[model samples]
Target chain A: MDEINLQRQSSTNDELVLIEEFFAQLTKPKNLDSIRDKAREFCQRNSHLKIALVTSGGTTIPIELNTVRFVDNFSAGTRGSASTEYLLKTEQYAVIFLFRHKSLEPFWRHFSSDELFSHLDVNPETNQVTVCPSFQPKLKEVISEQKKSENRLLKITFTTLSEYLFTLRELTMVLNELGSKAMLYLAAAVSDFYIPPENLAIHKIQSSEPLRLHFELVPKVLRPLVKFWVPDAFVISFKLETDENILLLKARNALKRYGHKLVIANELNTRKHKVTLVTEIDSESIQINSQNDEIEIEQLIVANVVERHNQFIHDQSSR
Target chain B: MDEINLQRQSSTNDELVLIEEFFAQLTKPKNLDSIRDKAREFCQRNSHLKIALVTSGGTTIPIELNTVRFVDNFSAGTRGSASTEYLLKTEQYAVIFLFRHKSLEPFWRHFSSDELFSHLDVNPETNQVTVCPSFQPKLKEVISEQKKSENRLLKITFTTLSEYLFTLRELTMVLNELGSKAMLYLAAAVSDFYIPPENLAIHKIQSSEPLRLHFELVPKVLRPLVKFWVPDAFVISFKLETDENILLLKARNALKRYGHKLVIANELNTRKHKVTLVTEIDSESIQINSQNDEIEIEQLIVANVVERHNQFIHDQSSR
Candidate 1:
């Protein structure tokens, strides 16, 4: 048993070295400083509230340096955005939302293009445009809620895998100042493989030839994120899978490997309606009631997460 | 020369067979019938006006059967959507817009999320939502143009390469009834390669393994599109390249091989401000003047195209 533990530790050290090399090769995002400044300002203004870093959407992997082509993961950012809205409603937490550019956002998700366009009325004579009567009440409520939370919410957008990882590291290091008061809610579907920059084509690939692509495994950064970046912060990672049988197993393995506080496991088909919260000792499933369709599963998931987080803070204080 | 001609004809026949097989293996989009119906209605209502089928945006290549990952070509549909708006302004043309889902659309392209959100005002007392005074004029103009052109424009959306090709074929066959009065503006950034259904994974690809992808060249349907489907229609294809030296060469090659009327060539870096219209006899470069910053280059390109299309129609009628 001791020998096995020693071998695992050595492997983790090698992985950490690879992760460091990955960052060294990547060009840091230009807006990273702005993101850090916004986070610092939020922390200073809402000193009494716990800070939650919520990551949403999927990171893209560019196939070439010029990047006329890219591999994109499927995510509309529904879970992360909805969770942020619910967490903000608790009033105990302020959120820094790191999301993919142009993905669904917190209050804005309610108004899709079709819904918004259909509900708009234009008066040609007066040159006036008005939101239709039926949509006004809902629009008013969302706008008011959005205005109220404006001070507490900080949004930072990223597109590529390198941008997402670099921003994640930068934001977490800044939030580490809060110690146990900070929470990391990582929900972005990050790429697991990427074509190294050295191997990427600099020009648009011609269509006359057959194409072959080779991708190396992307170095796992979650291990360093939990163990080094914010050791004192409560971390909750999400695992999404198309296969239900391996879902909980993978979630448990992630928690055991990373030593994070919790793992939320969801399957692709039933993700909106059901999820399992897995920890070191046991797992609990959270499902929305089929009879009441009005409630979002994120609302229930956020409530449960807040309760557990409160208990964690209490235990830490006592210790 | 006769032998070479025979060899080229045989290869094209083989390619047409492959294209037919490619479509057979794919599942048809559920909304295809509605798209067909919409095209029929537009044609019936606007019999007096010349018809144009304008394709925009980029098509995606799914990496798996269930499609959690896809390789996407880069296009914001700027040229296509802008061209559609200009074509409608002529009042001589009714357009059937076939575009990628969620890409920029005609008129709506002017209002991005930030622009729309910042220009909105909510009245607290009456729960009234109104467009701000500063934005009302532009909003009113766009809304009124949108309403006026509703009857003349038919909008159809597609996502994957399969959907785009299928819809393109269906719409062209329907528009063929108009003969020389119809124009085909093929502007979409379509995929050059794809993974056939037989080679695709059944579920989400696991991250634990190194990914190796093999792609076959997508069969060129342009040959059959011109020779068989709507052979009498005026066809204009686009060639986009990163290398400037090869741009005009490739554009001319496309016209010679496909026997199309024109090829619009543009480099990736200079696409927005400049483009070259390549025909069998000559090539002309249309550039936006530095002095005039207000006019879109699409307006100039559309004017040139309309003039050529009118000449072609006049020639056919005289024949």
Candidate 2:
């Protein structure tokens, strides 16, 4: 009975309703065609390389159409960006990074805007500034690697939940043409509830009275995404919960329902320190502790994922 | 009867209750005492100069104690930041900027992270990057001016509404010692509603079910601030409304209720384009459009405000 209910929930018409409403509300992102063209050209040029579609940061749900206020999930794009750096180090894949506006990004994520300034010294005489000596090694590595992969990496930003969903679907469809050569990492903290276009207030919400906000469940885009859009590609989804007891259960359920390749489960507080990788065959907890804390956990997570990805490619080619 | 009711509301036990509750919930900011000491030192060393306390950006109200999600107002700190730059250019006043973390800051706000990178080139042979020639003149001017005023400027950041209120009260108490020489610019778009500490969930709110959030009204800190904290100092508050018709009315009401020196009235859509400066004696609309669009409205607003501040000081001294 439980399985039947879960199956029913996955196939519900609610998803179709959501997709329709979402499309109706979208204002076709201005650079959509240009981004699509660039991605196609990059893929064609780097045909021998494995390609990654990494979605980072959190998507926001505007409380009002004019958006004086918003409902925001807590994601700084640390995991996705750090993982991208690790993936790039392997030199095996071209990356298409779809991220939330103002969130962290690859390489640059390691330094804040203030820190960037502190690492440069103004030459008062020449009226110019250059990178300070101590930081030269790291900055040089980043610049060189970035130059090498400039043609292979594309970054696009989305702010609202609707924009993210539309872009995600479009990007996945384009990448699907590559078959098993494509990999999708859905790391963005997407909102579970949203005020549909028809229900959203047209102006900034008034604060004169007690504000009562009503949110509807966002349609499960993962269903259509896994079953139809990019069925051949390896997909990984994230499951974040505050309660430890329910974390694994929710993650397993998501894996079973969505039929995705893996689910990364984590507790909100300890997310940076630990994460559990759940797959059909096994569940593994990855941790960064006092001794190994010097190393970022994403480095380990990405290495393990790359190994599995290589295995997947070999198996597909052999078959 | 209306005046009596307004007075009663201002001194209602509700405000006291809210203050007590707010303090009880606050975790002393890590650098509170150090920041206070620095401000005191700055004030003493620069006793001859005027000092402005500018609060910018928007404060967040976390939905859960663990805070995986939050309710946030959309303010990029443009007005406060731009105004600060203008005030600094006068070289007459020292500034203490209390702003939302990661929001735009005074001089640096003018450049985006991407733009900063675009203005630099990395030499492969030397493995060092330098600012491109075209951008050097502007960068030099900004750097020199910033260096000249570094000692007179202090910046502190706050993220949560509780932190902002606590810091505001603490800073105001310190500044009150300066008496008529101090000015307060409350430009932050603080949250009107928040999930109080006692009512907040200990964990991230579960999204499996429909989310129903309950929020309590945030006490009007401006009342106690103007009435007791810094009664002798010039206080300017902002009134932002979506409806243009209500904008000036709300600003006037606020001025009467709080007895603040001035109120800046603005409609949401036209906030950047125009604003009405409201005072007890008069109101005036300041705008930048077809002819003066090249000029930032903050420049004009800051100039007018500085002129009034000068007149206020002269008037007080004569009395």
TM per candidate comes to 0.95, 0.93
DockQ of each model against the real complex?
0.72, 0.56
lDDT of each residue in A8-85, candidate 1, tens digit only = 999878877878888988767888888788788889998999999999999999997878899998899999999999
Candidate 2: pairs in clash = none
Candidate 1: stretches off by over 4 Å: A1-16, A289-292, B1-15, B289-292
CAPRI-style docking class of model 1 based on DockQ: medium
Local distance difference test, per candidate? 0.89, 0.83
For chain B alone, what TM-score does every candidate structure achieve against the true structure? 0.94, 0.92
Candidate 2: chain B TM-score equals 0.92
Per-residue accuracy of model 2 over B214-244 as CA lDDT, tens digit each? 7767767788788778988989999887778
Q: Which candidate number would show the highest TM-score if scored against the true structure?
A: 1
Instruction: Look at candidate 1 and tell me the lDDT of residue A47.
Output: 92
